[model samples]
Structures are given as C-alpha cells and as structure tokens.
Target: MTASASESGNTVAAVDLGSNSFHMVVARLQGGELRVVDRIKTMVRLGEGVDARGRLDPAVRERALEALDRFGQRLRGLPRGSVRVVGTNTLRVMRDAQGFQAAAESALGHGVEVVSGVEEARLIYLGVAHSLGDDGQRRLVVDIGGGSTELIVGEGVMPLHMDSLEMGCVRLARQCFPKGRYTPRALDRAALRVAQELEPVARRYHNAHWAQAVGASGTVRAVQAVLKGLDLSPDAITLDGLLRLRECLTRAGRESSLDLPGLDADRRPVFAGGVMVLLGVFQGLGIQRMVASDGALREGVLHDLLGRMASRDVRDQAITAMMARYHVDAEQANRVSGTARHLFGQVRRAWGLDDEAEAWLRWAAETHEIGLDIAHGSYHRHGEYLARHSDLSGFSSQDQAVLAALIRCHRRKISRKALDAVPDNRRLRVERLIPLLRLATVLHRSRLDDALPAVALRRRDDRLDLRFPAGWLEAHPLTRADLAEESTALKRLGLALRVR
Candidate 1:
C-alpha cells in the first residue's frame, strides 16, 4: 500500500504516565515538525510505595486516577489517532495493571499503553535526538523517571544500544531515604545501588563510545536546574558539579531543608534519589559533561504518531525484522496478506472496523506462520508465544497481547481461551477479525503462486457469506473441503461462515 501522511487533524497530543509525574504535550504537526501549543505536567508520584506484588498503594492509585481524569478532560474530544497515551515503569511493573488500566482508560476516555523498558528507552532517545537533529555523531541519552532510568546510545534518530535500569528517583528515594534524609551513609548506599544497576551494561555506554551526552526527563532536568540555580555548575553538568551538589544536599540533612533555587517543590523529596542515579551514571559511564534536552518521551510519542499517520510507522519495521528473524516465507506471506487485505476491505465498513483493525489483520496474516520455524506441529501456539513475549519495538504490552491473540486464533479450532488474551474493550471487534484471518489463511493453505478468484464477502449480523467466481470452489476441491471444515471450526467462536 502507498504511504499516506494525511491525518484527521494536524493537532496531536501525547500523554506520558511517568513513574513520578504525568505529562501531556499537545502539538501541531506541520511540515514534519512538532510545534507545541499546550503542555501539562502533574506530580502524582505513581511509583511511590508500589508493593512487591506489583500493586500500588491505594492512595497512590487514587492520586494517579485523579490526575488522569484532568488529562482526559483536555483530551476529551480528540480523534482516536490524534492522541497517544503511554505508561512507563510504574505501569510496566504493576502486575494487575489491567485493572488499574481499565479505570485509568475510563477516566482518560482512551486506551493506555504499557510500554516495555527498551521501547521506553527508544522513545526517550527519539525525543532527545529530534531536538539535536541528526548530527551524524554517536551520543548517549539519559532519562531518569520515577521508577526506572533509560540510557540509550545512538547516532542521529536511531538507537544502537538501549537499556532501562530498575533504579529510579521515587523507588530509590523510598529505599534509601525513607525519611527524606540525605546523609552521607544513605547517599553512599544509593550510589552503590545505582552502580550495581549499571555494572552489566556500562562498558557499551561509557564515554568512549559516544561523542557527547544528553540528559532528559524531569530528574536530570531538575539536577540541571539546581546546578545552575546554585551556581555550583553554572555552565555544565560535570562530576565535579555533581560532587558539590551532593555535598550541599548532604549538608542540608533532609529534603525539607533543601533550598536549591531551580528545584521545584514537588521534586524535592525525590531530588536526592534522582541526583544519586545521575551521579552514578556520570561516574560509571565516565561522562565528563552533559547537556539537557527539552524533549522527552511525550515528544517522541508525538513524532512516532506522526510517523504512523504518515505510514512510516516503526512498528512495520519491527514486523519486517521479526519476519526475517523467523525465516518467514515472504512469497506465501504476501499471498495471504494480500488476500486478507482484500477481504478486510470488503467487510470493514459493514463490521465497523478501522485502520488500526485492518493493520492488525494484515500483520497477523503476514506473520501467522512464524511458529513453523519452532515446529511443524501446532506452530500457531509457538507463533502466539513469540508474538506475546518477543520485544517487538514500538508495541505496547497490550498491543503485543492483541497481536498475539490474533496470531493465536489464526488457525485451528477457535477457542474462547485464545480470544480471552485480548483486553476486554477490544475483544468484540477482535472476535470479528479472527474469522477473517482464519478464512484468509484457509484460502491460501495451498501456498501456491496461482492467482485466487475474486471472492465477494458480505457480513450479515452474526454470519459471513463468501461468494466466489462460478464453479471456482468445484474446481478447487481442496479449498472446498477446507472451507467445509473451517465452517465447523468457526462455530466454536460462535460465527457462521458460508462459502459458495
């Protein structure tokens, strides 16, 4: 398909649910650049006090929802594709995230994507790199959030190496300075913890690998503010400056005593923890100097959404990469994909499907055979596993879940269990998509290059009727039998398929 950049509206919004704060950026997409018209940031500290079982404290959950309710108001009437909302470390670690996600989506009136750590790192790098443009120089990007820290090594807009460390401002603060004290001992312990987190990936990210370093997100920016605010490191972020800041913070004794000029009051409690994490990066990575970027994840999201509108989606790249990795049959996959797209166009309007659903159907058709590499027996299950677990860049956990569910139901007896993998809100439409994918694969079961006869597909409430060229099914007896069995199989999914 030809790529199209035209979208419903030029205005787009990105909401970032960071561990420490929630931020929203509304921008106008013009000539491939983002012009910010409105911005919102609220400190809800969503990462604080998350239990081991991945449950947030009730008060913290309430606080997060309240903040999202306000964000939803601003985003109330925006077109679906015009806004992108993502949750980072806090949501990622939340085991029962779907429960909270349901409430959060209700308040926001939009779906929330819980992105993987590496994906978050990629978005962070995208945000930081866009501001710098493509300098053709390798650089290190660091973003400190409330629950995790992302470090990316990249040249221009692409990230070559990325890692999301478990250490974050809010998590570390509660661990080392529960009472908000910044004593030397507590600070040393926090520093040690940060060093340990970086130990595994420090070699690839050290100063020797990058031309320059850039800091991003709230924590690093807060540190920048304090350093300049206090005249400690008026011109640059240096280890020396960090050392002096640490001294000042330690001398102050506690968060309440902190009097840094550039630090926001809301950031005070977690400031010490953020500082320690950044300081450790400076030391561990041997970063001599660093600069800050105004852009972060939300900006990256807007850029990504813009790409999606333009049909330059990075997720498509991810799908292609995955197909290549799994040794997918390009020819056969194309045959199925073309057929699926053809059928989707037939029933899209009748069934109320949209571009997103069409995209998912096409992806499922293309990669349905990814599991054949694992084993010829029940390859569908293997494909489903890989789809669910593999870190396909640009896909949220829920996105992966939906894609996996589609892959799972692409063949064999459709099961309620497989459809259950999809989130509740989307299950109904996906129920509609499953049969299309199954039918497409069934029609292409021969895996030949021969052209298929035109098939007219119509949706009538709960039943789908497919009419082929006169006597096409009689000439293709194998397909006739496959369709006969397919009809019975789809009955498990409560759908009636009629082939003529």
Candidate 2:
C-alpha cells in the first residue's frame, strides 16, 4: 500500500494481524499529525487453531487469508513503503510462517513482519502513550489480546519496562472452556491460570507502580463497553463491573445464548473467558479501576516507523546495551563490527541480505564474546544463554532468538543440530552469515595495537576463502591456531575455510 505524503495526497495503512482479531488502520499524515481515515477489525481468533506443536491449523489460515483479501483491496492505493503489516503472538508460534507470510503479503500488497513479543509490547505502549496525549507521568498499560497479553509502563513516549505474556483471550478460552460453556469452575480455573502467569511480573509491576492504569485491546474495550452499557461508568472499568459481568456470564452459561449489548458478536465467544482472565488480573493485583485506550500496537508501529525514518532506531540502542552488559571491549567491538559490516556490504547483494541482516551482524559482533564472563570454556554457549534469556529491553522475541543463535554458532562445531534451534525461515540466513562471523572473529583474536593485515573474502558455493597478506598467518601462530580450529568447524557445516 502506498502512503501518500499528504492527507489528500496519499494514505499510509497499518495492519495488525493480531491473534484474536485482524485490524487495519488507513490514515493520512497532515502537518505531522495522523488523521485516521478508515479503521477495520474482524475477529479472526488465529490463536484458536494453534496446537501444542505450535502449528497454525488450516482453518485459521483460511479465515486469516480471507480477511486479508478485504484489507488488501482497501490498501490498493497506498504507496509501497506507506503500509506496515505486523503479526503478533500467533504468528510467532507458527513454525511454518514462511508460506503464511508470503500469502498474506500477496493479499495485502505489502510486506508482513512477524515481530517478537517484546516488540509487540513496545508497540502497544507506544499506541497507549500517544493516545493518552503525552501524559508526563509514568503509567502502566495492559493489552490482553487473543493469544498474548502485553504489559508496559512508561513515562511520556518511552516504555521503561515491557513484557508480553503467553496468556491471552483466545488461548485461555480454548485451554479452560473448550465447550464454550462458562461454568463457575471453568471461570475460576481460567482466572487462576491467568493469576499464575501474572505471578512472575505481579510483584515487580506492583512495586514499580504507575500513577494510573491504562488498558488496551479488545478485552479491555469490551470491559469498558459493558461497564458503560450497565450505566456504571464510561471512564474506567471497576471491580463491581467485573463482578457483575462474571455473574452475568455464569448465569448465561452458553456462549450462543448470551446477550450483552456492549459486546460485539465476534467477541462474544471469547468474551466470558477474557473477562475471567481480566477479573483475575483485577483481583490478583488489587486493581480497582482502569481506563481503556483506543491506541495500541498499530499506533506504536507507526510511531516506531517514524522514529526509524528519523534515524533513532531502538535496535541500535539495543546493540549498545548488549555490548555494555556483556562488558565487551569497546575498541575491539568497533573493529570487529566495522570489518563484519564491510564484508556484509560486499556480499549482501550477492547473498540476498538486507538492512536487518546488517543490524544482526553488528549486534552479534558486539556480544560474541559475552561468554568470557563465565569460564572461557565454551564461552559461546554462555553467550548464547545470556542472549537468549537476558531481558533485552528493546529487542523483539524473534530478534533475540536470531542474535542468540548467531552467538551460539559463531564458534564451536557448526553442526546442523545447532541451527535447528531457530525457526526454519531464519535458519538459512543464519547459516549464510555464520562463516563470515567466524572468519571475522578469528582475524580479530589478537586484539593488538598494530594495524591488522588486509583481508579479502571470496565465496565458492558453500566454501569461503579468506586470503590474508602472504605469510600473515605464519607471522601470527596464535592466529594460525585459531584459524586451524575454525576451519575444522566450518568443514563440519560442509564449507571449506582456507587461510593464507
């Protein structure tokens, strides 16, 4: 979709392929202000079909495809870079998302990015922050979607802490009330499950308390609507309203027979389950009131895109943070990052790489030696663990996974089993970059004051040739030993690494 530079000139669209609902926002920018021209939402509940093995069922795919077709038609006139499409929790779970993403991109006439959960939380907070009119006070924002729940607290436009939990409306509904019956026992179980999931974050969230509570996404909207419909309050949801909603649901029992004017028909099926989870949230955290906001992931995406266009990419910050946290030698990191980037630039086009890969290489170089903190014995594994589990503030879940995998495989055996950890869609790209990282890491092993010898990179099928100055390896025996070991590892991955 083409985003017009002018409100009358052209339009930019943001499509949120959420687990519970697929949402699209068509808007035009006028004097740096966004005037929303069109908004579309359809409850697709993509999470409903995700099984234990993390596969998206055929039925869910069909529904999502059909919905995207409609959204695509609406986006036909938007400019190429004007439209941003993102998939949330369910998309993250899909092991075979390549096919789904390709089809969705074709239907929408735009690229679809399946972002990580932390990224999802970040966007949710941005949307909430913007919708709240730049409130200076730090506030907690909660977004409970069909497949995941995002909690974020931030002051102004920046989120200080963000977390995306696995619990969500659709997943909870399927797990707790598969028959679509809202029995008291079922409701209680669902609420308890949510409570259990929140336990990890509850104390910290409560202690790092916000002055106000802001809710986002369909569940929050539904709760606010029901409260208003009952003439309780239009401003925020109350404990009494929650209790009333739960009682009403328990009385109704069957989803089909339930009648609630405030709830939409598409939302009705999972409404009771979502309410149970929210009610648990209220009780678990001693929350008395919360104001729902219309802004969410989509708004966050637009704001982030703007930030990127303005050259303030958060991923850059993330790289810096990782380097500092891992206590990396700044000068050496810069040297490696520079060299890796140089090699990446030379081969990116030939290898079908892009900016994202470039960023990945930079980040991997920054933290490649993090394992040195632990015993240097297999520091690569230590680095991998740190990258994988560290509360990397700015990175999405997918980004972390990729970075961690690169760190893990940067050294050692380069086994096919190591690459198996990452998703199949990303495996090939990681494999292509691993040899370059290894070669760069080996060249920088000395970390000396003298200028390094010039190096050239050549690729032949799966093999790579690193031709250094004549006799450079002979002059540096330690470098020679490292290269000798690295060559053995590369050989296992069906690639030959030669050093001159």
* Candidate maximizing lDDT: 1
lDDT of 1 by residue, 193-290 (tens): 99999999999898889999999988878888888988877766888999888898889999889898898889998999998999999999999899
Tens digits of lDDT, candidate 2, 190-287: 87899899999887677247888889989999888888888877789988889998888889987877898788888888888788778877776667
Provide the TM-score for each candidate, comma-separated: 0.95, 0.86
- For all candidates in order, the CA lDDT equals 0.88, 0.81
TM-score of model 2 vs. true structure: 0.86
Off by over 4 Å in 2: 1-13, 27-30, 33-37, 51-56, 72-84, 92-116, 348-353, 421-429, 458-465, 469-474, 484-500
Candidate 1, which ten residues in sequence have the lowest lDDT sum? 1-10
Q: What is the lDDT of residue 144 in candidate 2?
A: 92
Cα deviation at 259, candidate 1, in Å, is 2.9
